[model samples]
Target chain A: MQRLFAIIGDPVKQARSPDVFNALAAERGVDAIMLSLHVGAEDFAGVLDGLSGVRNFEGAVVTIPHKRAAFLQCGSHGRAAEAAGVANVVRKTGDGLHGDLFDGFGMVNALRRAGVEPDGRSTLVVGAGGAGVAVAFALAEAGAAPIQVRDRDTDRCRQLVHQLTQSGYPACEFADDFQGLRLVVNCTPLGLDPADPLPVAPERLDPDCVVADAVMAGRATRLTAAASARGHAVVPGEEMLAGQMPAIWSFFGLPGETDISAAKR
Target chain B: MQRLFAIIGDPVKQARSPDVFNALAAERGVDAIMLSLHVGAEDFAGVLDGLSGVRNFEGAVVTIPHKRAAFLQCGSHGRAAEAAGVANVVRKTGDGLHGDLFDGFGMVNALRRAGVEPDGRSTLVVGAGGAGVAVAFALAEAGAAPIQVRDRDTDRCRQLVHQLTQSGYPACEFADDFQGLRLVVNCTPLGLDPADPLPVAPERLDPDCVVADAVMAGRATRLTAAASARGHAVVPGEEMLAGQMPAIWSFFGLPGETDISAAKR
Candidate 1:
């Protein structure tokens, strides 16, 4: 039987997960399909409960408002999600549901795919949402030190920093100091629209810092474009999505699927 | 977002509903996918409840043991399913789930497509299983008076006759008499397996009577092959499936899809 995979989120029509996943599956003969399940936030848990009846429903990728709620449904969590207290992936194991966060790991993998590592690097993340926390957790795991987080939601920023500190990483507050940073990541939706401001002042980014943005669709966010113009290495969100698929596919036990970045199908 | 449709049954993998439905959807540029959901009879209710979580789920096509059980979940029943007390199609409408059965209607349509009409014909349906009952009901509705039904299970045979009689159809029990019959249909699993016996004795069939088998996997079952070898016209189960699609697509509110039999997609 063909397996069913779902990406559940409110307003999920914009998510490119299904586009890339389905293309990769078809190109590689995976006999699988990924659907963007635009479930309302209020119905997230009820929907999960109901999905138990779908015998071929292998797993679901969680996003946005449901990230935290979906995590509660998982019986186990990967260390990355455990540290971040957020999940981007959920798998159905024989025993039960297992949750993991891939956004952070994918970012690190994207960096490696781009020929860089987080060892001894100073990093700044501008968002305390699920993606921001995942990036911070992954950076810590990759040996980044003194990670800084900022968000318009001050409480969320403080909460993320506290979560990072509890996870035993050398963490600090973002004070707009990007001069000597080796990496600068934007986890917010600051550059999603044409009129939106960049998450940070692109002019302040150090020429050596590798700039990355998690908001995809636009491909080159203002921050990345400006950083690229200034000769700084830039990582696009699309690359991160591709990088995450290897881990996500492994979670689905379909690891042979070719990388979407390489397949481009 | 792409809509989700499911075919629910224990042995659902072999059903060609997904193949034709998905093909029609793709051919017409409709954003939809039909999945084969293998659910045990025990879990049928649970699965239907769970499917409620799928916000994009439009409805499901039911087969075999679960058809009657599924109709119970429908808030309303279309006239055909109501008359037959069974549903092969369940659709999500603004009012709620609406159940309908197309097997009978499809049989009549298939006969018409094959250049034969059930009007005023003497019909005998072998096997009083779901398919058998459906064909008998359709024959009755098409004005085949004194419709005959036979089954290995006498209770079921009696039950279907009673149901048809209650629906104001001229129905009776099969007395192993096929003389002068214009139509003979095999609706049971007989001739499904190579070792299984033919549903009816070909020697007893009138060479001028039209024969049909509702089991399609083998397309030409022993019953159909024998009837054809004996110089009788044969209608394969594929026609029944094709005839059913028009009603199914209309139930899904996608009536513009050309007949899949004509499209052969």
Candidate 2:
């Protein structure tokens, strides 16, 4: 039977997950497809209830406002989801639905793929929403020190820093400035609209500093472009998204790249 | 945004709606795909409730055990659905979900397409299940008279005949035998398994009696094969399913054949 998976969020039209996941599934000859399901926050629980009844519904990728709600719904959680208090991916297990956070993993993976090690790096994480908190936790887990968190909502930013401190991550604090940070990751939505300003002043960063944006625009985000022009290495959000696919595919029990490669040989 | 549609049934792996609907949707360049959702009878209402919360879920093709349940859940019904007391297709309307029966329409449409008109023809419909009732009502609406309905369950068979007669379809009665029928349609699961006996003996029908089977076995059913070998016109279940696509597509507000043709030019 062809298994059903969905990326659930409100205003889901711009989601690239269906295209990305479907293409990978097709390439691997898996009998599955990921769909973009536009569902409001109010209807999240009800929709999950309905989807649970479908035996062929293997899993779903939760996005945006639904991530935290999905985390709450799961019977169990991965370490990353537990740390971030949110879930971006869910799989139906024998016992029940298992939720996990991949946003932080994706960000860290993207950085590693771009040849920037997070260990001992001074990191500044902008935005304290689900994605920002996830990135902060993952960076801390990857040995990034003195992680400075920033968000327009001061309370949310302080809460994230406090959570990181309580979790025993060293030197977690609110960002006072962009000074001396070796890695600056923007988890804000600033780059989504063309008219939106860059999340940080790239000029203030050291020329060797690496910049990453979580905004998944079709092209380069303003922050990434500005940082790149200044000769700093930049990671676009798409790479982070790509980094998450293998884990997501495996979570749903679909064949991964290695399996496909071996089968071909 | 890509729309989500589903064919919901118990034991749904055998269903061909996903293939057929997905192919047509692709041919028309519609951003929609139909998936097979396996939900047992007990979970039908819960699943429907969940699906209703999906903003992008335009409709569903309900099959087998869920047909009557779907009818009961619909806010309103088309004439055919009301007559059959079941729904095989449902669409989301501004008010709520509206359901309709297309099995009867599909059977009649297939017959007409195969150059065997049901108008004023004496028809014997086997199996008083959801598909059988739908086909019988459709045939009656298309001017097939003296409709003879039969099923192993005598009570269900008598109920369909009574309903048809009460709905003002003339000469509706329970079948005693295959005698002198101009059209014979098998709506039972008899042909699905090759070991099962034919719903009716082909030798008992008149030489020119048109035969149709609602069983959608991949290959020709024994009844259709036998009737065809004996020089009778035959309509397979696939043709009936094909006949329903245009109406189903239209019901979901997707572009129809004419629109595709026009686009091609």
Candidate 3:
């Protein structure tokens, strides 16, 4: 029996999931097909209604705008989805559609795969959006100590810190400045465009710290370049995308352990 | 400046659009990036809100669940999107997002590329889902003399007939069986699995008919295989996916002139 999976969104043409999963599926000899679905907000309910009736479509990977809805739609959700109020993956269990978030898992997996474990490390993270939240939660779970989160929106930073600690990381804190931080992550799109400035003051960065930017600009992002120039190792956004695939495949009940680093080769 | 294109869906990972578009973009000198977005049903408004505020992202390809919403959300829709009451592509303009559907275009392009024009020919399309509607519309627009549509639901067949004529195809009709139809299309998943029954009874198919199955089963679908055994020409679903690239690219304000069939070679 062939398993069917779909990635649904409003403008669904640019999705890489179908190829990624299908590639893995083909390698695994599983008769599975994955397709991209363009779904709009108004049609979300209807699309779900239609998908719910289809037995072959075994799973779905939820993205922006729908992550929160995915959490609510599922009969049950995992702890991370419940905490972040978002879901990056869903599966059709015997009970119903089960939703869970693998965003944090992707982040943690990326860090671990890169041999840069955040456990017990003092970390400084910039930006507090969706990816940032996932990263923060993942770092907390990874045993990172005293992780400092910064965002232009102080409230969001405060909320992330609260969530991180409430979720069981006792060392979470809000950082108004980047001092005494060893691991720095820029999760904002500040460096995606050539015109955008570094998310943080270059002079303020610790020379020995490891920096990672969640932006892909062909080459190193300004933040990554700056950090590298200052003798710090940097992780690119592609690494994060690659790191998330294994968990994603598992989320879909598909086989294949993915190493995003291998994809770079 | 890199051109921005996107595939929007609630769960966007399961999409080949990024690979297809990125490969196309790499082949060209155009600095462009294709990405997937996960948007939820209620988040449609929020997605539009986000798109309006962004600078780099330009156009998007809509997918299932969001097609009807895209049709409703667009400032204006083309004849095909309007006819089907759905859209698979949306180009952002100064006025707003303009919607069109390339599903029909893909089928039309495939037939034209294969030297089998839908115009003035008899077409028997099986299934009445989104793909069927698009194929039917394309055939109707291309001036097919008589088009026959059938679905499990008789009302759906009636609805298709009404929509086809409303779109200016006067010769549209519903048929309970494939008698003298020159073209046979299996738009349903009936032939998806190796075990699934052929959409059409093999003995009922005309040996001279052109059989096309939209279900991609890695080999000829049971319908197509049966057609081949009976000395009929066959079209695969993968061809449809490949054929839609050019028109879809053009609709996105990108160059899709390169034949997608060549990609297979």
Candidate 4:
């Protein structure tokens, strides 16, 4: 029987998760289809209740306003989600719904694929929001040393650093200088608009640094574009999306890592 | 934005509505998809309540064990559904969910396509199930006189005749003979299994009659095969299914009749 999967969020019309997964499923001849559902916060509980009746319904990618709410709905969360306090992917388990935080793992996976080892490297993570927090935790968990967590919001930044320190991860204070940092990531929404200033100035970074942007653009973000021009190995947002799918497919109970690029054929 | 349509029933795995409508939707470049959902009896009420929260859900084809249950869910029924007290299709209108019966319309529409008229013709309709009753009502509405409705369950059969007669139709007693009847229809489950008897023996039918079997077969049912062998103009079950699509597409708020065969290419 064909199984149904969905991406649930308020502004789901813009989501390409369906296209991404559907292309892979069709290529692999898997009996599955994923669709985007524009479910608002107000309708979240009811939608979950209704999905109980949808026997073939597998689960969903919870985004935006529903990520935290999805975590609350699940029976349990994976270590990353429990630590980060949010869920980006949700799946139906034999007992009930299960959730996991994949942003951190996805970014690490993307970097690792590009031949960058996160361990024992000094890093500057720019953002105190969900993605930034996940990135910092992943970097810390991967044995990176002296990880700096920065954000425009001081309270959120303090909270993230505090959480990492309390959890015995290698999170630390921000270094005022970024002259020789091995890794730098823009987890903030700064890269979405070309007019916005770069999360970190191009002149201040090491030319040998590995830079990544969480926000997707039509092409490379201003930060990534500048980083690439400076002769640094820059990872675009698309790579992060691709890296995320393997983890998502596992949560969805499909057999291991999917090569989404090759699956397009 | 993409719209979602579904077929709701307990035993819906065999339903071809998704295949039929999805083909047309893709052919016309309509931003719509039709999927089958298996909603069981115990979960019916909750499913309806929950669907109200499904923002992209447009409509559904309500099938077996749920048709009459669907009538109860509708805010109002169209003429045919009201007359038959059941609905095979439901659409989301601005005000609420509205329903209509298409089985009767489908039969009349099918016969008309084949250049056969039901008005002023004597017809024998087999079975007293929902489909049979709807067919009889449709025939009566189309001006078929002295309609004979028969079934093994006499009370249910008598009840159908009473409803038609009380509602000002020309329905009458079922006759034991079919020698001069202009049209003969089998709306029963008899033709599905080869071992089951035909609704009406082929030996009693007039050689000039137009015979139709509502139950589908891999090719032709024994009754249709026999009728064709005897030189009677036999309408296969496929035509009835085709005839139903116009009504279903209309209910789903799409434009005009769908040529399902051409859509496959």
Among these predictions, the greatest DockQ belongs to 2
Question: How well docked is model 3, in DockQ terms?
Answer: 0.07
Error of 1 at B173 (Å): 2.5
Task: Give the alpha-carbon lDDT of every model.
Answer: 0.81, 0.84, 0.71, 0.79
Query: What are the per-model numbers of colliding residue pairs?
Result: 1, 0, 28, 0
Instruction: List the candidate 4 regions with Cα displacement exceeding 4 Å.
Output: A112-121, A126-133, A151-159, A162-168, A173-239, A255-265, B111-121, B127-130, B151-169, B176-241, B255-265
Q: By lDDT, is 1 or 3 better?
A: 1
Q: Candidate 4's error at A234, in angstroms?
A: 6.3
- Point out where model 1 deviates above 4 Å: A111-121, A143-145, A151-169, A176-178, A188-211, A215-239, A255-265, B113-116, B127-133, B143-146, B151-169, B188-204, B207-210, B215-238, B255-265
- Return model 2's CA RMSD, one decimal: 4.0
lDDT of 2 by residue, A1-265 (tens): 8889998987566777777788787877888988889899999988988898899898998876788899999999988898778898998888878999888888887888888999999999999988998899889999999899888898998899888889899755555666788999999878888899988989999988899988877688889989999999999887776667777888778866533222111
lDDT of 1 by residue, B1-265 (tens): 7888888876666678888788888777889888888788887887777676667888898876688897898999987787667788988777768888888777888888888888899889888876777788888878987789998899999999999999899888988778888898888867656778888888888778999888765357888888889999988876787678756987888748446364344
Q: Higher lDDT: candidate 2 or 4?
A: 2
TM-score, cand. 4: 0.80
Error at A21, model 4, angstroms? 1.4
TM-score of 1: 0.83
Between candidates 1 and 4, name the one with more favorable DockQ.
4
TM-score-best of 1 and 2: 2
Put down candidate 4 lDDT per residue, B1-265, tens digits, no spaces: 7898888876666666688788787767888888878888877657766676778988888766687888888998988788767788888888878988888877887787787899988898888787888889888999987788888899988998998899898786686877678898898867677887778887787777899877755477888988888888987665665678756876788865555344323
